[model samples]
Target: MAKDYSLMEDSNRSSNRSIHDISDPSRRIVLRGGLGMAIGRLLAPVAAGSAGCASGARGDGPLLGFSSVPVSTADKVVVPEGYIAQVIAAWGEPVGLYGETPAFKFDGSNSAAEQEAQMGMHHDGMHFYAQDGSRSGLLVMNHEYADDGLLHADGMKTWTAEKVRKSQAAHGVSVIEVEQQGDDGWQVVRPSPWARRITACTPMSFGGPAAGHALLRTAADPAGRRPLGTLSNCGSGITPWGTYLTCEENFSSYFNGPEKPSPHERRWGLRKGGAGCRWHEFDERFDATRHPNEPNRFGWIVEIDPFDPGSTPVKRTALGRATHEGATVAVTRDGRAVVYMGEDARFEYIYKFVSREKIKPRGLRENAQLLDHGTLYVARFDADGRGRWIALGHGQGPLTAENGFADQGEVLVKTRQASDLLGATKMDRPEWIAVGPDGWVYCTLTNNSNRGTQGEGVDAANPRRNNTTGHILRWKEEGDVDGTRFRWTHFVLAGDPANERVEAQGNIKGDAFGCPDGLWADGRGVLWVQTDMSPSAMGKGDLTRLGNNAMLAADPHTGEIRRFLVGPVGCEVTGATGTPDGRTLFVNIQHPGERPSGRSDPEQPGRYSNWPDARAGGRPRSATVVIRKADGGPIGT
Candidate 1:
């Protein structure tokens, strides 16, 4: 969700539905025989061992065994030569969870209650979990925002209330624990009782159907069922009962409103002077014209239970909130629970939800109300390569109340105007959604520079136009994950197939990297990906021959792709996970020397990257590396 907190603007005026508004544009790229023969007949029955794939991609032979790691404007961290990379719980470290454990003071002087026990700031979407088998676990992650010029200590000068509570205690979620120390590698189990730190001022609750609606009350939450935290925490998910979802992407650039805002604050882009993290001049709930339902208690998803560090962190709201960027659960073969999500903006839409019971063999107190009862839906993608989902249910079809949806909690709080009055499909910025050991699903579209310019053109599930390097989109649903029909394609179109400007040359089959953002898939079918490309467009122009931000792995049945890791100079390789005997992995990197106004000047904090403390004027934190395998086996093998 970076790209300087996603910029915003395009408030979906609907009329979307574009793949050239189809009507035999050559049956839109030859119907089902095109996105490369429908991704080789939907990954050729999961590379032929079908039946719901994922037995770790069935004894694979070359599902990426390493070796590829080149394009790296090196300020540090590039792996693949038997692999090693270390770093760990970076940004302001400590995270020993509560009380003392302080220690992260390279002059930013900690505070805000020691930046709420440290380790928060940048590090987007992560997971880990394990326990002892992988030698320890828990990790968690997502501190998606906060650079107030490297958080405090004279950065946003004179800004007070302890620099808005240390930039809302460096925005939310961290969890920690880690372990694997026998060879002296992954540490941080410091005070571990499963560590913690769910910040932005923690305490959170709210559950199903827009919990206590009235546009989420809030005169300091008179009854919006409590939601005093979790903001901007981007892309993350892990549940099957284990818990820890996070999400909330650009929470309307931390709000500000009223200069003529309301149309529900310009359809969630708020502004009137925000998107600059002024914390509304000192957090009166980020002052959206005086707590306008406190930015409807933040674009939701929350969840968290990373083995209960004294729980309390819910915000589910039947999963509808927009701007989310990550959720990815997938279950429904009767075990109910679907999820999926995406809305990272720029023409938005691509949600999921499903649930309504099932999933029982108990865990987080018997599935904690399975995401508070669901149904959401919203995808569309049609010009032939099929896709459907629709149901943003409230009085269905155009959501009734003669349009402004009067119930299901204002149709999940105007979930992008009930997905533009149920017509949906206007993507190109979707970001992270995984699900595939081969049962498809994928996602990631992270690009969309106002695709085909302001008048909004191109489509066929976003067939590049001004899309500036993006693409991944998979799909397959028609029967499982509570099917509402599905078919999609295009699993790779990221950049450099010898580009010159054919819509930023993509269709990459290996290595080339571009915006893709973080995605995962692993229990073997590989497909990792990552890349974000933004510190003001990295080395410059068409991503200057793609030099930094990388992660790549992919093999989803031979569409190949490789480049494993490479992040540093102005970072953003973004959150990945591993370890359940997959050896190690972890990843993250985010905002490293982020500039081009996404903060970091505090008198030139190492001017552009001093990654993992390359010193000389350090401060570029946002870490998490780890990666292993120097014969410890597993990981991309």
Candidate 2:
């Protein structure tokens, strides 16, 4: 077969009875004692600032534009002294070409039809694609998930069909044209054809080896290629070919309807109760058993062309599906494309797909098909600070009929099993990934609470027994960006230097933060790290002192990190993107007023964050903020 997508599925699937619960006894691999010690010794110097990160590749110009911003728990965004931030778009705001929708009512009163043309909630992972040389561009952003209490006029206690419809309308990607106005001001360019919405109800198709697999077929789409909408779009990336790659994370929570669980269904979290959304109550398709394959239709990387509003988003199956955090691309010396992705679950593996064909920059149609075929490889870090990319290709070692893979399509469908069979290194809830200007790869290993309590044993890559405060991991390819072998090291072992988490670990520097999640490498190679702390981890001890989730800048050369901006209380600092000129920066502040303990308190419900409108008593809405320096300097230079 002339394959465009990578192949090789996994066989280590959890039993149906225990699928939702991932403590699969049959597939546990433990590396104990000396092996773990050796790995730890190899990575010990990273916190001491001794190895791995490129020392001489610092970009020219000022390394930092302004002094570090002080941490705050205020209800507003605190930027560097001279910089200013303005709310550009919020949930329920009309974002398309003007006149298409009415002005948004600050209260939760927008109809489902109205919200379809409005900006979605929980704004995240945005990119600005320039049109007239940065003067104007299309801002494509992801709407991760929604909160029912604040999203509707009446809370979840009285959620009507209209409320459910409006909520679904708010769960996808938004593309709006924006232009710089009079010096530093930026606003949405209404009435532009490029301004549109792609929500959970948007039409999309799966392409690559698993496009028409049996697992993807649903009653609504017998062909198995067509799927409706993308959900829980967390981190995302703008592809070199000018398309937006919106990731589908935690898509498993949307489905309901099944008393007895199948192993496959359990693995994806398809159970009797919903993830509090209870959309299954209103829509039959949301019920997994009624439409068993609907959940499979999601969880793929969906690519969208922002410039073309009429384009049908494509779910690229070449990249194996899991809890996909996002896909960041790095081009090789020979023009081939390499996409680095994180599976976003504890003990899950990190993955990459290298396209078979070199990219031809001249043709959009041809370049769009580049992601269709590739060789998928999972990472396996060794105790010697070295790592290898194990191929997930069919007919390649271990991936065969005997191992549960019938073909390449099956390999892609069951990617987690494929990695297990290949013995890929299980990471600590890997989240976002970004390739730096120096051609090195950095990934955010968000906290894994179950590290010591269950599952995998401690290793150098994941040194902590219970990794409450996660760390930043960076790797350099042995030869080129496409090299199979690589050397890796820790960039940030997040925690306050004064705290025991830091003292016991002895791997982080003086300046630190916890739960490192959103990560991006700016044009100047300065690494921007965002924090997403759990409620239970906050409000006390060092976490309380760490304050609200914030964005920090790291000098790759010196490995010195400094806090740049702090968001309002209870908000997750996420999705950093700037204009090509690096003058204007865009960030998403998601779910303010979120409980500190990650649990909803009925007595004090919806009292966490009052952001974007703290002065007035209004519902907290996740919005995108545009930040610019007064002197028009490059952001985080």
Candidate 3:
């Protein structure tokens, strides 16, 4: 999740078609009747529907029974000889909600009201709800931005307003309440009432159809339906009526713009001395030239009920916003809901929404406005493996009002300019979106060194042209999740299939990884995968043989891929979850002493990783970790 590239907003000039033009050799022998029988007819109906998937394995032989764990330029956390791990919840700890649990003072002096009761900073995408079931409940997560040199003390030299309210109380979302403690394992149920946090100032509201539009009016929420917080809170989702969705990535690097910045704030990268989190020098409402609609109220998809700790977080915005990178709900077999998103950067796209209403067996108060009424769609992919979703509604076609889209809340606050005027299919940076319990959906695309550069070439599902090792894109929808047509492939392509540079040689069949950011697919479908690889590109070049950043599991019915965990030095094996009896898994790890100039030198704060408190000079927090199976069996077995 470190591919900001100064918010590379796609300027898309239409002309779609490129999934390598289906490798044209007559559409590659009629749409790949080759590449291993086109990935065995795209995973043989997900391994012949694995006996109706989802039940935590065991009647299996090889769904990845834990063995693979190699690549490790260590610093700690490796797991896989009957796994163990530990460290439950980290960053500035103590998310005891109002009972105040503070206590995480490892030198960065912790206070902006004790980091708003702690725990926020770099841990991305999460979700593990349960209740009294799987040992306990509610983990929630996604505090996706804030490194500010190990979050201040003398770090940004002395920035004021209390280091901009402790870096806006370390950017949004946390929740807490965990349990499972028989063998002294998962803990954190601190002042539990579903121990909330939700920061970046936490006030939130805004629901669908661009909430109160007028480009989300703001001179301090002019009825633009609130929106005071939730910044780059990356990848997350849970909802089958339970709640918690998160998303909202690279929130235009937290405002500041306006030295001639308007083309919708330069298509959302804002600019004019921002992106460094000075929080527009002590929050003048982040000064987008004096709060110009506060960065259009943050790239959305909020939701959040976590057992209603006084619920409010909303921002659904009909699921349109870009830079989202998460949001994977699914339901529709006639219940409606759908979701599925992704739009990390470099030539963005890939979206979904569907929910016009239907999910009701009495949950979250009759599905409280079920995602504020949906129908977003944006994909396009066709070169013949098929795809097409389009829609972005407002007068349909060119999203009219003469192409400026005057309704549907300005086509959802210009969702990437209405998917670049509905031409879509521009990816290679689309972060997370899971699904697969045989319904197949997946997506990661996490690498794009500006694909083949100059105007970003190389396509056909982003066919590596400088892609720096990254792949994984599945699909299926031809009928269910409110189908709009689908059928795609390439489930794995991440690097080091012995690279000598054949686009960084990837086709991973065993253990070789690079940049395939956090993804999920649990409930027995395996497919964990996590990886981010960017403490200034770890060891350098083709990601220096993919070491540190790790977490893998994949088995979408025998496509086998393992490497169950590795992560420490300058970390980022991002948010994963478990424990609906999958016997505990958690994961997270984020900025462990992140240097290579991505901030942190608070006077040698554990150089490049002191992970989970390696003591001696402290300061490298961004925790979570948990993992189990020291015979308590279940995770990836």
Candidate 4:
């Protein structure tokens, strides 16, 4: 039977779970862009509903090349008949460091020093960047968090300074150099100068209006311009200009707030006691009462330079903060850079940032400043397939002193407040979004069990009740992507193919999926969807036939979805990307055998999933897997 949903879930635990805490005022702001005018753009509807997958035609990409694999409760990775998967990097694999590299310890005895140069835990969103024209490249990945039971020799029940430090070193991003080995395999380039790890202890700086804001001040950096690290990074994106965008989600649970919580802090899920991870017990900075503004420093989209590991990662503030899922870049016809983002909490809003200046392709440094100044907007979706982007800038409307927004900096720091006042449409837990080749946007509303039954009921956009299965939403800008108006529709109401709800909406043919989380569109207009379903639901109910969390391929044009690969037991399929040539595919299998009722006592054998190891007494580890066809053909062809 499924566990009581509310009791089994903590504020710290959610789909793609990451945590932090905070509090603020409830003042309202004005909406600058007229919603009435925005509706006019959608009146003339177009026929482009789902993505156009060119692969269906002759001489295009492959046409669902392999048969669908059956659902299994086995502890092994499963793929279509012609495809093969190989593990590349795991939790403790050493990449490279300032000094010498150390070997990974399977006994969980590796010191904090070793972890600095090793791959972090809970591999999440990632992207592959070709460096040597597809022969070799950099694979940038996010380490969501560490599993206390597996990270420590004796578990988190008896925490110490070293254990805390080791965990901290395991919660950021990894940029490792990978080179092709054989026709369909790749290996990590160990000790390569290009391989490096950015942990929660790495030094980082801030950019945009909120860089020097008072809310960001801390004893270590009174200027409030620099923060010590990044944590709770969930989903991510790769920018057109070559930087990696790693989003900080659910950061509110990181801080242990004051004795009396403020309304804002409560809303952000700040707890009086330390967060579940208990980092505050070792580092006072995590205690919000001691460092009141520390929690404010997180919850922003951080950009990292994969090619230059020595360069500092930056928290881009022009894109307002919340529980940021990630940021996707879309370039307009005139060269402007537009970023679409989703705040990943239930009822949170979707947002976008339009750069003030056009993109400069001269050099990285020449174009780095483009993201420093942009107009941020919150989305408001209507029941009639229309939507508007409300400007979140200062001097726009009611964003004055009366509304608690002193300036643009204040508006960004309190982004959720600003959007609430503007009446932005509340969405289900929105996660990663993909932009098809034709410019239509596809987003994953990864379920919202907390939704009420009435006004927020089944509408043209979010059409479901107690949406445990979730759905995919798509929209297109009538003119410029930065324009205030757009047309929207429900592309797929994800669920069992046999069910009436899914049959009436979803365009699935081969394999069906639920709780779509990580979404990306390859250059060929194929939409890749990754699943993140609850462990109990994996083999029961409408999802019983779906087996483990798997990655599916969907033709944007026909809306046909086919299961491409299924992960090991207890794993969440996320962090998917392919090489520039599309011959090699990289997908992360996170927290395999992480079932809520699974064994966790180290003294016992096969405590969870043996996974990639497939041994009788092996422990589960989150690792990045490489997938390719046996014939060395392009993936998902």
Q: RMSD for each model, in Å, please?
A: 22.4, 8.2, 22.5, 7.4
Model 1 TM-score, all chains together? 0.33
lDDT of 2: 0.72
Better of 1 and 4 by TM-score: 4
Looking at model 1, which ten-residue stretch has the lowest summed lDDT? Answer: 30-39
- Winner on TM-score (3 vs 4): 4
User: Model 1: per-residue lDDT, tens digit, 520-595?
Assistant: 7666667688888787766666677899888888777767788988888888888787776677878888887788
CA shift at 345, candidate 1, in angstroms? 20
After superposing candidate 4 on the true structure, give the runs of residues whose Cα lies further than 4 Å from its correct spot: 1-63, 453-463, 498-509, 540-542, 597-600
Please tell me which model should have the higher lDDT, number 2 or number 4. Answer: 4
Per-candidate TM-scores read: 0.33, 0.88, 0.33, 0.88
Q: Please, what is the whole-model Cα lDDT of each candidate in the order they appear?
A: 0.75, 0.72, 0.75, 0.73
Error of 3 at 433 (Å): 6.7
